[model samples]
Target chain A: MRAHNLALVLDTVATSADPPSRASVAAATGLTRATVSALVDDLIAGGLLTELDPPPRTGAGRPAAGLALTSAGPAGLGCEINVDYLAACVVDLTGTVRQHLVEHADQRPAAAAAALAALGRLAARARLAAEADGLVMAGAALAVPGLVSAGTVLDAPNLGWRDVDASALLRGVPELADLPVVVDNEANLAALGELRVPGAEQTFLYVSGEIGIGAGLVIDGELYRGVRGWSGEIGHVTIYPDGRPCRCGATGCLEQYAGQEALAAGEPRAAAALGIALSAAVNLLDVPVVVLGGAYATYFDRLRDGIEAELRRRVLTAGLAPVTLRAARLGTNAAVRGAADAVVREVRDDPAAWLRRVG
Target chain B: MRAHNLALVLDTVATSADPPSRASVAAATGLTRATVSALVDDLIAGGLLTELDPPPRTGAGRPAAGLALTSAGPAGLGCEINVDYLAACVVDLTGTVRQHLVEHADQRPAAAAAALAALGRLAARARLAAEADGLVMAGAALAVPGLVSAGTVLDAPNLGWRDVDASALLRGVPELADLPVVVDNEANLAALGELRVPGAEQTFLYVSGEIGIGAGLVIDGELYRGVRGWSGEIGHVTIYPDGRPCRCGATGCLEQYAGQEALAAGEPRAAAALGIALSAAVNLLDVPVVVLGGAYATYFDRLRDGIEAELRRRVLTAGLAPVTLRAARLGTNAAVRGAADAVVREVRDDPAAWLRRVG
Candidate 1:
């Protein structure tokens, strides 16, 4: 029953365009009026939902009460750190974006602290705004342009950061310290972001941009985190055995040939590997829909056709369902929006009590 | 209560190595004796289960009646076609293997008729065995080694066939015409086989070995069939752009690179590409567990270190749970076993009269 109710509520809110009333919930779910009231009450007590004012109906004898996200409830903050800038957003229990902020930065490791400080201030403002709007932050997630292991940024060659401790950096902000701050590769988060986008539950892949390329795979609506959390890293797939030197000390890594800066600035000859490399990845994964996002999405089309052609030649299945390649709907805000969504998942799913008391 | 009773019967049977008595089923599922009796009646009425003689307990007053899967019920077949051979196995409703058969054939499309004849002969033998034991045949499934879409094999490089009508192939056997037949990629069936493996629910990436290499993916215990039904075609990922031309007219696809024949022939360079390509794939998916079966599992040790190192280069987040890379327990039988298991899934989850009807 608990699982069923959770599914019903989450499914309802996720599918509905706007907040609904108890009567609607009952009507859609086919539960009794009393059952709807009981479920709604439980959800309210659990702090996973709120009551909103319903719009007046033309022929209604009595006005229905509305339910929506509460402003003073717990919230989540998600920050997407790209190659040259950062974007952040805060969300409440109902998946509402309360605040979004972006900042620019240098790629040097030395600039990381200053950028972190700026991020701290931006997060402080978001928390304050969330509080003003009656939502308290329950958690925050930080996505970076590198390989992250636990709280440490192990290797972000593009940023020149070697084993940078992102969790420690976020810890400097007292307002964000106590919350469970998650940090991972920006691409992985973008993949999740794309998967959560409306109507992305089937098989889909996300190609995230920034310093390097990262792919996120979702099969049947579940994230495919390969052994060791490195399932979608296509940038370093060794496109040329004798290609340009990769930051990871390997020649011919896909990043050297197709990475954002590499593809953007390198001669077209260098970009020739994009088709072969991406086709290699696509053929292996067999994802029907591929969404390109990140700082490099716009520029990626320069090589998209070649990759698709190569895929046509190499994929085992001919006449495959046309792989829909589209720009991400969330665009530049994919990571931040996805970050806020993680909180939405938590609060909506009924997390720890204190954390559960959300918008 | 109905659902609970159904789960009880299934769970009890799943847990028991040998058949259990009705009283034992009642105790195991926490149901009243009357309820257990009533449910068993329903189960027998559906063809899914039957009664059997219990193994005598040393000091028992009287032997308890053993409840077991009905051999007279519906069955599913997993037929595998490789470069030069065809194999089929019949599975009972409980997912138990009842019969297995195989034959060799030329890769020529013209030989499809001969292969169909072989299948008909095998089916006849299987039917004879089932009738000798008083069992009823239910359904059959075919696992093709190629790019299958909508009941057709569009291309199977190993088999050197294209656009072969798989659904029509079964018509060669008149007895099978009345039965439901399913056809899918062999690799996909292998992945389902892994999902049905006892005590395992983690994501599974099943790679099969026969003539050429193929792969299957299972995420969250469900087969991840891409939109075109062409997902899990890892063999065709072009790892080499300008290298050796493959049968598919592509250079450096995983199959052309590390396929069974390629690896067996000592394609040192191709073997190297195998590890790197898989490493890149695993890292990109963020799936912590990878079950390596089929062609690659034999030389897994050769590919392990390189794949792991390459994976480390691409993976971003480091989670505490270590990614598990293990060989499949079912060995070459995974698909046949999985075909049987698929029948169990359909029978157990839906209102199937075939499963419930008893003689």
Candidate 2:
């Protein structure tokens, strides 16, 4: 009961626009004030929460003490291995990034061990910086630019890696050896990062663009990994049959049309192709929101008009509710941040598990 | 505890290949023999379950008295208003079709009242047959060839229906006046029927073809009705960039290439176009199975070669697990059977509700 109530209080505090007081938490959670106070004490002791000064009141008998998430508390470590770079970051319990680093290096030609070693170095640096800031490192997760299942990279065409154990790659580093390391697709992580944004739509698609195009689906604020965690391969979605050949050996694939290389090279049809493809996605999934990330986010201003025009022409429900297209706020940093946030999500979803181990 | 145990017993009996006795049910559900017996008695009295004679055995100390769903118990009524036909069926607790009827009628040009009136006649015929067989009609659901949400047929292009109050259309019939009717897309119902098949894949796409190509997604054996239930619009997916115009106004759409009219006319490009489109779906969703329904199933033998070749070439997981393509077992009857089974599914998912209503 204590663990459950603690979660409830944490949720109420996390969702409130302003810092909530013990009384407010009790009222919101239907728990007694005494129980809320006891739970808050336990949470504060565990470094997951903190009490704040009373807010300046306009009209009140007495200002209630405010409670909020601790700034320098248990933090999560996140890393991402992309085709052109490796990134790592540390995020606190309040979803704030404390330390981050990105190393740009062409990874496609590098050996799997060498690329993983470089990524490990970046992760270690972030971890050291996080420790210096007086934050306890909780857990770590890695985002890979490919299909991943059970912490193993099944296939990464851009990285030239296949069947590599991603968790094993991180185990070589002593700082992360004891920590649980989860491996998932980078696009999926990016979507999770967007979903965690305050006041973001609960259901939307996050399209990530690099040399290749991929998408991550968030349904009801939870990332949908699909069976076997092999979903979000939108790059291979056929666009124009007999139009352009893709590296995946498919003709007229979306990647051949809307990929970073295609758009950057001044292909006149790139944005239009993206729009036509997105129309199919909207019609098939019935999701009303789409967030462009990575290169797409960076170049969204240039491509927005063409994409919207295509949507207006192809989308069946364009008249009912115009599909909302927006640029991803985090851009290139989203994958790494999402990886770190994924680690934090574990504790947020089940605080009792954290309490069992730490309390 | 009694209500929960009753549901468990019904679930176990429904899933079991052979009739299970009270002892077996107790072991399966972790309930005491007395508890199982008491719940079984209530279910039997409610006419939801019945005792069956033990199967003849060559050697046994004593035979266990078996239990099974009663054939003459409460049943579900299913009706379908398609582009070319009106169908209705009654399915009992055992998942057996107790009564069925079908009438050919082109619904596109017909007035809304006229089409609904014809559908009502088909529903009445099935309800009467079910009553003659001593089966109690539980509920009714109608499958239309279009988008549906909130028990309303929002739009059915082939049928030229928009903002149709389907339940109100059936309310005029005396037999169904008191029965609550559900309205949904035909493809969605077909997918539900496929999901209910014994040993069916947990996640798959069911493609229903007739005049247009519509799809239903079943993820983990439940229909994935999008937020507003406007999913599975596969016909609108673009194929050729500047090809023949579709009724939905998109140029070079899949429906123009692979719809029933195209395939039936022996267009050589139809099967190939279907393959290219399905490849996109497989890559995007990573659902390893695709079930072809309606005309697609009837003509599977002819389209098999082209579809298989495309899947082999385009599916990313072709090296890991080749995407399996199979014909829907229920074929033409899938929608009607699914509509009836859907009503039965409500009770199967919660047999205690049926027990409460009757006992």
Candidate 3:
């Protein structure tokens, strides 16, 4: 727990692009000067940070040395593997995406293994780029479009994956074998990516719309995985109990009501379907924000009204608060951005917990 | 905060019907001997607790003195004002309902004031009864049926109240004028009352059925008041959206679909309507418990299968855990019980925060 707090302190300091000093760190963290010094000493000793050129002493006062992250050491690798393509990026502890690579797979279920292999190639290319930059890749992050449970891909109709042991398959990749690979549902990873963004902290719903619609929720600053880690199948919940039959055998499921194809052909935007589906969700949790990504962003400008109407119904007499309905700023690259975030989490927990366990 | 904790300490040990010793308190709270000793001293200093003859030693140590609540000081009070009647109770900080009284009102718009006056008389009688037992009530609580907004009764259709300042009106009753009186929706209070019951901490959706259909959500050990303090209006959210104009000018509200009148008229249980209503609530919070109360409890058993089946269609999935459904143990007295809880809360907050501002 203390290590995690210290890691947070490190993140707070490193992410402060203004550049932080001892006094600033102490002020920002509300920690005593002594405590900040102790933590900073530990961080420097670990080689994660180094002394910077001292600030110019304008007056008859002592000069203060600044701190900065070192480009040296093993960096983290983030990879996004979808049905049609694979992408990987290597990032330094400071969240810089130093290296990136991409590949495409033939659109067929029979080519899943090749797709994964293509991901390996992308990861290797990114790793090589990092090494060229004099930074060794420390760990690997693999994100997939599917129902992921504890690092395993349960099903991915879009990718034709079923009963796939994601952890095992990724473990067999030569470059990733020596480097730990963390796996998660791409939507969850994307939500984390967005959450880590400088200013998106309030509880809200995140909907990822690629071939399928999946949702991830952050409530009161924590990700709510729900009972089965699938609390957010906004795609499957019945919007119209008898409207249309879905592949999952449910009639009028939200996917059937508002999937990418449905919205692409329908009168309203994807946000409308999300709005109707989430009106109930928002009312229940009182979440006031919705972030849309993937194909849905195409029709969001058109569907804003429907979403707002549903939101209005669930709110109190004071009316619903204005919820941000912004399109994913990173667009189609959300999955890759999410993977990068996973890498950061890994580096934070990696040293201690990783050292405590082995397969 | 400390009062409630101390009450819980005494109430927990009080279950044995034996005075608790310092060792027992330490065992109950999982606190160290020194901490429990300190708390016990604080309780003693506040005159809320007393010491008794030592209980016979069980193990191999010196006999330990027993601790118990004193016969003096503030206690809990709850009052529920229904359309036709009023019920009141005085409970201790430990939740023991020492006195209960009830009065019926004449069926008219102006009769509510008369009913309250009668309630005051009954309250006085109860106080006389408590005086017989040497207990002085510290405060009072009131629950109303309405869309209560910032201490104003926005509307209580059944009681013919519109824009009534209930807090100000109730102040005319001198017995309660000097005492702190807490007022809230009956459903919210009932949920709190149920929460205070031993082992009811598991998440539960509370349904109150009287003049209207009301729901209270307890998620993860906290009451979710929602955005406008006006959430849980299950009665108002449109169910059919196209069927039956509601009193609130909406079409197909849950109450319109599954209300008592609808049920008695043999409206084939609209599980879809109710399930959709609650599934939306459950999806947002992801809690796994539901309890039915008031007039609705009698029929919840009959509608369980249909409710679960409908919920399965929209909320529950193949592997996600199922939310448990139960009837409230307090039966119809939940509002009164909740009132007692409100009293406990009032006495617990920093007393200075509660002390009326002196002119």
Candidate 4:
């Protein structure tokens, strides 16, 4: 009960639009004033929260000090290994990005081990910069463009990766060895990052267009990872049935038409092909919104019209209600930032775990 | 608390393979024996459960009476209006069909009111039969081949229906005037019917192939209705970007290739087209199982191979784990049976509602 109350108080302060006093928190939570004060004190002592300076005395009695999440507390390390880039960032408890680093290189030709080593170095630099700002590293998460399960990259056709044990390889790096690490699909993480967008809907489809096209399904404010943790393979949804061949042993896949490479090669039908594939997703899942991320964000103005035209023609409910379309606010930084936010959320949801680890 | 315990005790008895005594239920739920006995007594008095005959005693002191769901309690009325047929059935608390009636005639040419009147007559016959067998009708659910929201049939292109108030239409029938009625998509109801299949997975995609093709997504044992109660429009998913024209004002929709009319017209590419569209659904949703219901069940042997070929080639996770394919166990009766089952489930889940009405 004590541990639960501690997390509740911290989360309440973290989500508040304005710093709230102990009296307000107690009223918001329906907890007694004494209990709220005790939990707040424990959170302050654990470095998860801090009391803001009180306002200058007005005509009333003593003014209560407002509580807020500590900026110099535990932070999260986020790393991403995409087909052509490596990136890392650190996010503090106050939802601030303290450090970020990126390197551009063609990763498809490099060995998986070599690519991971480079990401580890970038993450190390970000972590050192965060620590210098008086923040402690809590954990780390990596975003990869493929099917991930049990710390393994099951397959990343774009990178020519299959059955690679990413966690074991990352643990071998001196900088990332000490931190607990997890691997997730890049699109899934990007969707999570978009979940924090101001006024974002609780459910929508996030499409990550890169060298490879992938999608993440957000349902009821949570990522809907399908059975076996392999869903949102929108790139492989057949668009033509007899068009271009794909490396995934299929013909007429959406990727062969709409992937970044296809767009870069001046494929005039990229937008139309994407619209065809997205219509299938919308028809089947009834998702109300579609947010184009990754490379698509950069080309939103060019692609939106074609996608909407197809949607208006193919979606069954197009006449009743139009599916909302938007460009991702975080753009290419979504996956890395979401990865770091996930780690911070862990600390906020269960502060007692951090408390025990620190002790 | 009492209402919750009553439902829990009733559900425990309904789900048990072998009848269990109050003491056993108490042990399973961690409730005191006296409390379990009182809850069980209330359920029995409400006609939701009955004490089964005790087994022959051998060495024990006293054989405790086992409890089971009553077969002659509240029942559900299910009705379906398809393109060429109308069906109605009654299902009792024991999950047994007590009455069923079906009429075959093309409903597309008839006025919507006339078609509904014919269905009302059929449902009245079934309801009379169930009442003769001492079963009380709890509620009614009607299945239509289109989008339904708050008792309104928004659209069913095959039947040429748009914004039809189904609840008001059904209530206008004298025999059904007193019962509460709801309208739902046929595919969604059929999926719920398949949920009772032995060894059914908690998550799956049920395809209802008729004059139009629709899909029902079942995740975690509940139907995943999309944002506006208008999901599972698989027939409109594009199979070929520029193939045959469809009545829905779209070109190359799955319905143009795989619908019953296409098969009746001897479209040689129906199976392959179905394969392409279903591949999109499986890849996007990652549903592990696909159950072919409605017209597809009658031709599963001929369609299975073509569908499987496309799935293996298009699904990203096919190499790691193959998606299972099966024919609907209930066959053509799945929609009507599921509609009735939905009503029966409501009573089982909340017997207090029935008790209050009966009193």
Model number with the top lDDT: 4
Query: Could you tell me which 10 consecutive residues in candidate 2 chain B have the lowest summed lDDT?
Result: B151-160
Q: What lDDT is obtained when candidate 3 is compared to the true structure?
A: 0.67
- What is candidate 3's CA lDDT for residue A230? 56
For each candidate, report what fraction of the true interface contacts it reproduces: 0.63, 0.60, 0.17, 0.84
Which residue pairs show backbone clashes in model 3?
Answer: B1-B348, B239-B252
Error of 4 at B325 (Å): 0.5
Each candidate's number of clashing pairs is 36, 0, 2, 0
Per-candidate Cα lDDT values, in order, are 0.69, 0.85, 0.67, 0.91
RMSD of each: 4.8, 3.4, 5.0, 1.6
lDDT, candidate 4, residue A106?
A: 94
Alpha-carbon error at A340 in model 4, in Å?
0.9
Highest-scoring model, TM-score: 4
Query: Between candidates 2 and 4, which one is better according to lDDT?
Result: 4
True contacts kept of 4: 0.84
TM-score of the B chain in each candidate versus the native B chain: 0.83, 0.94, 0.81, 0.97
| Model 2, span A59-166: residue lDDT tens | 958888788988877888999988888899999999999999999878888888888878888899899988998888888989888888788898887777889998
lDDT of 4: 0.91
lDDT of 3 at A242: 60
Per-candidate iRMS values, in order, are: 3.0, 1.3, 3.2, 0.7
The per-residue C-alpha lDDT of model 2 at residue B164 equals 88
After TM-score superposition, the amount by which residue B23's alpha carbon in candidate 4 deviates from its true location, in angstroms, is 3.9
Query: What's the residue-level lDDT of A349 in candidate 3?
Result: 52
Q: Residue B124 of candidate 4: its Cα lDDT? A: 91
In model 4 chain B, where is the ten-residue run with the lowest total lDDT? B39-48
